[model samples]
Target: MSILKRDQGGVPRADPLGDAAGTTALVLALNKPVYPVYVWFLAESAFQLSLLTALSMPLYLVVWYVSRIGNSRAARLGLVIVGVLDTLAIALIFGRESETLAFLFACLVLSGFAFYRCEVWLSRGLVAAIFFLFVLAESLIGGPLTPITAGDMQNLAYLNITGAAALVAFIALRFPRQERMG
Candidate 1:
């Protein structure tokens, strides 16, 4: 059997969700290292944000490994949890001014696409979690963890908005399409 067509056991290898998850993991991992350098370049004061991004790399690797083993649901859950937590961390660290909350919206969209129809409940729960985090960030969290000038905050905001938009677009493009019925 062709390697592309089968696993070592000769079973057909077909796991769209797993493939998507693995690809997401790889993309995130590859891009994550740049965040710190980029943030430092933008504002040395905001370097902590880069550290937070760096910390999330291990979680992405875990997601990749889970997907590689064909545990798509676990990988999906890992991605949602990691994305939600990472966005929340940025919000809490930089406060609302950084505009990092935009990433939470991306997380919400990610949760929606990460699961299938049969896993609707899981998807809903993840969406709710994202919403809850958004509310907590907007209402409960106040002020930046460290003092950052308005200009620095604005730079971070631009970075965040662009990052969130890219994340949402990636999710839309990478996930498998579903048939629509009239």
Candidate 2:
């Protein structure tokens, strides 16, 4: 059966927002493992940071699984929470010098708004949470948990930029096309 079709439980499984979130989570899970290679030559702390990121794979996988089980709302929320927490952790570790916060947070905000099309309050709340976290990490707690070389930071920035861009593209592509009104 097609993924978009109803499951045995009669739950609809074709939620565009959920699909986008789930796909994003799956993509992140697949890529997290490769992060270490991106900064292999960096300081041990940097390598350790990359390894820590890889540990979030399971969370992402869970989001995907939830989405597949016809719990799109929960899956979308899971994706948002995971993304927010993961970014916060990285931001705390890399501090203000982490060049990827803007892109990452932008993606999170986009997802937050897109995922709750019918629930205005939920959408606003999600965006507020993302913004609050961004400010807290970028302004209030802008100090690295572990020191990293400039070169290592640059490499990580590149990785994050690529990942964020890919996620944005995926969300856009997965968005349901609306029929134009006459």
Candidate 3:
């Protein structure tokens, strides 16, 4: 089924602004890596950041777009996998002391949103589980907790922002399915 399709009653439903608002809030809440990325992109040469963003964002979006429209079990599993990878990336990027606060905040916000909005308990549980798993894994990896340097920020920023996008898309795909069924 197309992600755009309406209910069986054939009545077109207005788009919920809450979803957009939630997505924006989620994106904005994850400011730790994003702020640094933006600064790095501005402070240093823009070529690499620009190039990476252009190349990566579209590919990520396409995966999300396809996942939204495709009901195949594989697509659903893929969203879960992407969701896991995104959180893992966040943990790796923000494992330091100064950044850890932001990381914890982002994780709380994302998981809380998922818990509140996701109709399926399975989805909610999966999100929560993966988040804690990554946190624990990062702790076990045992790197010194320090602030991100400008050089590290560049790559981390890309990962953080794009990961947010992927996370949004993953939720979008999962949450809408319950509405359609009901």
Candidate 4:
């Protein structure tokens, strides 16, 4: 049903980078997605967002190491290390705040990348299925999502639920199969 296309390798061909519809592009955009909530939750919103946002900090360090070491393999290893660390940080956030919707979004991002990294390294279809599930879950349940207030958390639960449905629809269109491989 989707428009984005993929090669037999399960790789998207639209982006010269074989992005599968910019999965890497959006995945790296943590600051943009979590920013509005960061503005709303402000300082009191626990360091969850801050921690997750810092996942990209290693880019600089990896750049330095890769430049000095002159090894792509080391750079890749650095990336894997960062992904694992980010996963731990996200899991910690998820463990502490299951009720928080922002935390759920963060979990989705972290878990998605974890799956991506695993699939690329392990060469397994099951991991691809897990990645697909994360995309499907986000596409279905993630969008301009946030928990406005304590009151909203309970009485306005429908708001988040509907927002999630909208997200699913948007992603359905946004990351179509046809656009993936060109």
Provide TM-scores for the models: 0.85, 0.78, 0.41, 0.35
**What is every candidate's alpha-carbon RMSD to the true fold?**
4.8, 4.8, 8.7, 9.8
Q: After superposition, how far is residue 35 of candidate 4 from its true place, in Å?
A: 3.9
> Which candidate number would show the highest lDDT if scored against the true structure?
1
User: TM-score of the candidate numbered 4?
Assistant: 0.35
lDDT string for model 3 (42-113, tens) is 434332332232222333344444434443333343434443454445344344321322333334334434
Writing each residue's lDDT as its tens digit, candidate 1 over 1-182 gives: 12435455332367565678688877887778898787888867889756776777888898999999887668878887887787777688888888889988877877887666656777888889789879877888777888987888889889889988998899779987651000
Per-model CA lDDT versus the true structure:
0.77, 0.67, 0.42, 0.37
Least well predicted 10-residue stretch by lDDT in candidate 2: 173-182
| Residue pairs with backbone overlap in model 3 | none
Q: Candidate 4, which segments miss by more than 4 Å at Cα?
A: 1-20, 27-45, 57-88, 94-96, 99-124, 127-170, 178-182
Maximum-TM-score candidate? 1
- State which candidate, 3 or 4, has the greater TM-score: 3
Count of clashing residue pairs in every prediction: 0, 0, 0, 13
Model 4, span 124-154: residue lDDT tens: 4433544554444434433212333443333
Better of 1 and 4 by lDDT: 1
Report the Cα lDDT for candidate 4. 0.37
